[model samples]
Target chain A: MSLILKAFPLGFLINHDLSEEENVSRDLRFERENLCLIKIATNLRLEDVNYLMENLGIPYKYKNDNYFLNNGLCVHWESYQGHYSVFISANEKTLFEKTKRYVDLIKQGELLFKNFDIMLKRNTRDVNSKEIFYYCYKTNFRTRLDVLEALKKHQMENILSNTENEIRFKYNNKNYKFKRNNKKEMFYIELEQKISLVNIGSGKKSLIVKNLKTNYTNMDALLKTLTERGAFSVHSDKYNIYCEMSGMQFLFSRNNTRGQYFLSVDRVSDEELCTNILKELDEEYGLNIQDIVYKKIMERIKDKNMRIESEEVQDDNSIVLTIDLG
Target chain B: MGKLKIKLLPDGTIEMETKGIKGKKCLDYAKVLEQLADAKTEKISKTDEYYQNSYLELDESQHLSDN
Candidate 1:
């Protein structure tokens, strides 16, 4: 989803209805998806603890996958089919403490994500469970609309929407759903599958597989999916972004900073179809894309007659250039 | 006949493969793509394509001429 967390107000998780024994045996919890984890003890007032533990179960990342890390101390809310639990064994004192350390660091984490787009929420993983204050911040723009506008300005034609309030489209073979939520009074958008054009899956060999698997627009759906599949991530590097002209999908990309655009057709299994599409693109759009990219680059630099210095390299998929300021 | 397949990955990787080309000549095409995409080689598998007959010689400019 385009819902990037920009800021988070620090809050505390408290337990007021604790019996002296319940207080000693129960631990305070943190709430989150990737950041929060809590165990459900049967002695608590939760009625369906047994049922949920049996049916929904904890995330497989905990039970099956080698994904958990002893990063920070944060115990979060665990919900199952409308039932919620936020307590764990006081015996997990070490985990609870470590998770707490992370929770406390979240106060510091606020500074780390202040300028960047991120999604955030407040943890109220306590016994007095009620409506908690959850917040999300968009890091890339003042608001989500700005993202939509920029996308439209660059590539708007490939879309179908019921009113401008909500739009759904496929770009690069991935579905994008963007819409305004009237009830929450927020605009939300999500990529059907996470695609990074920069080919950055985790960036490095880190065990922390980012569990960005939540549907921020629909928390109910998010919870249900989590309960069904558990937390998991599968990395795919082979993907495509395409544009249509004359009933053919041409792989397309627009690099504004580089001032370049690319379109190509390949492996379509039908050579005739490919030839036909190629003819249309050549006749309608022309074959001189280098000129188009050069012009666009000049326009971006605000000097229509700017002299450009460009380099194209072979034996490596790269082009490097420098603008002579002198 | 040889063909070039270019792929743009979700993880921000650009990959190109040469099909039906013989011998070290595929590397010539691959080098051109590598230059275009500007990505460092993370892994390379020398398939049978690298072992087949060197049917053509590459010029200094990489244009292939039949041996």
Candidate 2:
């Protein structure tokens, strides 16, 4: 006689509802294959299997020489065996039935998920919970695009040259245009504000600036110091309108019977801020500031002294500094 | 004659062995298989025969006279 194994829901079994004919049929079939089937659930701990078997009154059996220890499920059985085989064969009909039950449970479990969703919604009502807004507010600084728009709106031109190498912005009032050579470098234009500045260059030496407009002579002395050390300007504007030397810029504006000046250096130090005002200037104003500064400083030194000697040496960090003595 | 052997484990790991080949020639022989499998060489062993073959000198006089 052919045995028809009625498959009952595992939920029905857990609930102790075995009164139906379907439950009786499923129970008989499950009992027959329980030992062999439990072996397939080895990843489920021994304690869990023992608890399940004891509760269901099923006996446990172990078999040696089973290759299933290394390779999981290597048994071949008939697909339509009214009862599930000793092996956990993922046949189409079995998978379809199991998947249907799983989907039903998942649908039923949506009530719990809905409660979780309500809790999350209630928690997010607090202002502190708005983390996304906080992050956005913290990072809402003016971008390059914003700066460019602002510069355009201000109508700052003439000194502003748009090129791939650098972006030049001329402060019309200050009579000096700031050039940003590299992306990380920032050149600021303070119309009437006095800013302290310090710059550490080649040998980690600092150039001190107290007041940018007032300390023009001190700034020139620093430039001369840099020139004597061989780090001179490769470019200079006609009439020394602006000095671009050694990757730095110095801007001088012609006034009535005099000249007002601004010093721009890449970066300044705390000590330099105490002594002088340093403005960072960029090269590429279509003038070789380094050569101009070098020649000007050399001439001044030669005029003061009988002989001048200069030598350049590259340090371990590969920075070349030329030293000049008068 | 030396032959190379390659075995694949259940977890997709591969073990390669060079059989009959002497000295570092085993490495040369297994290169193709290693390339095909994209295997990292975890360990390597040289047999006693590998060292013996290195010291074995050919009978040069016999070959010279024959030539």
Candidate 3:
């Protein structure tokens, strides 16, 4: 006896009986030899299975001794000639491909973290009032020590000697500021004035920050609102203190803040990565990915309550935010 | 019984339209799809059918009572 695993589509079994002699004759085409196993992958809920058994005019029984349901996939195994064949079924490989694609996409970022590469993306914007702010960025470390150094720097333990990336710092009050400085780029800070407010829109309470102030007028206001509402804190970089707020993050050296112009961290790079990720998903999965990936990316930055918004300005211009000020 | 049309929008959102349903029953039909998709209704439009059925039922009862 040999073992072979097969995935069967559940839709095919909806109204078909596999046990009856007549039914068996019809479904024998689906049966395979090697006397081992049968597996079915199904997206049906238990209630659906029961409903089908009762109302779908189909007679079917569990073929394998093993029965379990998980993550929209049902698995079962049948024994033949002292061997087993496993069967799993789902729709059009979409479920499998989608799950695999999702896992792969997440892993791509996670691998950066695991490998110790600082994968960073940043955006900046302005608002009428300083009530709320939101931001998101990613950086991967190359090694455990790199992660430790980055986190330690984030925690403001030891300052890095080189590279004046934007950093975050917390003042005496709960007030937070994100600062960054490059040779050519000026430094700026985002200040949040209040927590957040919930307003009814189209019958649902949409979390929003009414008044917000930012250093730049061209910056997206919705991004600022999300950052201000999200959970954030100050961390240290090698030479700068950084504010990590939701998804919008920046490092600031003390010297970078002398002027009043609130410089936005690299928005182009941030938007590019976002566009790349979405493009990749759309190309690979053939499914139009929503903001969920970006939302999850923002959520992973910190464990806190937050909201995010993304807006497109130009063909190459966009902004995103993560806030948990409430 | 009025038929309820529930559609999963292209954006992966659920939109529910209740035809010949009125009052709380419209909500009931909407809730069924809502529960199925774990979704919140973003916008709801009260159709002419809804208002017509609601008023027609009231008018029929009023006419019968007059007899």
Q: Candidate 3 on A72-120: residue-level lDDT in tens?
A: 2233443433333334332223454465422122222222222211211
Q: True contacts preserved, each candidate? A: 0.00, 0.00, 0.00
Ranking by DockQ: 1, 3, 2
* Order of candidate numbers by TM-score, starting with the best: 3, 1, 2
Against the hidden reference, what TM-scores do the models get? 0.19, 0.17, 0.22
Which tens-of-lDDT digit does each residue in A170-261 have in candidate 2?
44333322234455644322122112112212223334333254223223433454444344333444323344333234454334322334
Best by TM-score: 3
Number of the top-ranking candidate, with lDDT as the measure: 1
lDDT of 1 by residue, A1-326 (tens): 01122222111111112211222331323223212222321112244333333343333334421222233322233554465543321222345564643333333233222211111121112212223323221121223445455456446346776654566665555555555555344444443432111111111111221111110222222223222322223111123233332122344333332223344542232344346644443332321332333334445533322233433433442323333322
B1-67, model 2: which lDDT tens digit per residue?
A: 5544444432223355555666656567445444443334657677775666554424445567789
Error of 2 at A15 (Å): 46
- On DockQ, the candidate that comes out on top is 1
